[model samples]
Target: MKSLILYDSMGGNTALVAETIEKALGARAMATDLVKVDKDLDIDVFDYDLVFIGSPVIDWLPTKPLMDFVKRKMKAYARQGVVKPSSPLLPGKFGVSFGTFAGPHIGEKEALPMTMWLNSFLEHLGYAALDQWLVVGRHHHNKEINLSGRLGNIEDRPNAADLAVVEHKVGGLVDSLSAWCA
Candidate 1:
């Protein structure tokens, strides 16, 4: 099925997850496209059967660019012909939300709510928000908060193990999507 992965990252952890997902989908994906959300993003979310969105959680929220993309795209999708009159998303579309966070205060807990917010954007667009993924990243801004350097020690977070998990999740999601697409 056609798939799209959109991401915005500051610390690079979220970008790694996005790239991993793109690689895992590979040739099985009819057309897999990866886009880095920015001020000039020009995309049609309704064009894809499956969409994976990710961002770095900053201050308990998604990066501003990612949030802006969703808001802008939702308006654009509404004006598109393929979007059903009674539905928010194109029929038969699905979505997944993911994020990375370096919360020295609560570690992975900080990533959860942010991912949920990202998923809600898809939900509002009538897509069945399928899953949410979170990855721990090294905290650079506040070394004091990361006293133990717990997650900070890992030089390259969203590292091999984290990527492997992404691959596995993508495989599972594709399996389920295949059944639905068929």
Candidate 2:
């Protein structure tokens, strides 16, 4: 099946993960529609096989724009109805949430605050979150950053330790999504 993956990156970390996923899924996946959250074509989410979302952590929470967008989308969906009978693909629609951040360690619970919350929202709304990824940085330097988040996003330039933690998080997320997709 095909899919659409979109993300907002502050230090290029989130974008890196999105592109990697596109590569992993190969030709069946879009491979190119990696739109910045604020600048984009209007999302006709139902037209795709899957729609994946990514963002950056801001103060240990999801970027505000992402929250606003999700709210808008859910409202639109609820007003329009969660699923349409004529569109079977619409019912099984899958979502994935991710983020980039520099933060206090949470040991076994390595996660960006915003992404973690978004994952819960998706589940509570009854949508399946297939892939979740988190990219990290230790400092706030764009020279070390490579992407955008929050619409007006934040970039946490990572220290060596932060980079290592992000790597581990992404690995676990990849496995999580793969299992769910299978």
Best by lDDT: 1
Error of 2 at 75 (Å): 1.7
Give each model's whole-structure lDDT: 0.81, 0.57
Per-residue lDDT of candidate 2, residues 32-141 (tens digit) = 35666763336755555456677766666666666676677767777878644343332555667866654444411345556767766566456566656665543355
Clashes of each: 0, 9
Superposed model 2: Cα runs more than 4 Å off: 27-32, 39-41, 83-91, 104-112, 142-182
Per-residue error for 61 in candidate 2, Å, reads 2.0
- Over the stretch 1-182, how does candidate 1's per-residue lDDT look in tens digits? 78999999886778889988999999354579999999998987768878999998888889999988877887776676444555565568899999887666667777788889888878777888998998876665766544565455544565798889989999988988788778
Q: What TM-score, over all chains together, does every model reach?
A: 0.86, 0.62
Model 2 gets an lDDT of 0.57
TM-score of 1: 0.86
Judged by whole-model lDDT over C-alpha atoms, candidate 1 comes out at: 0.81
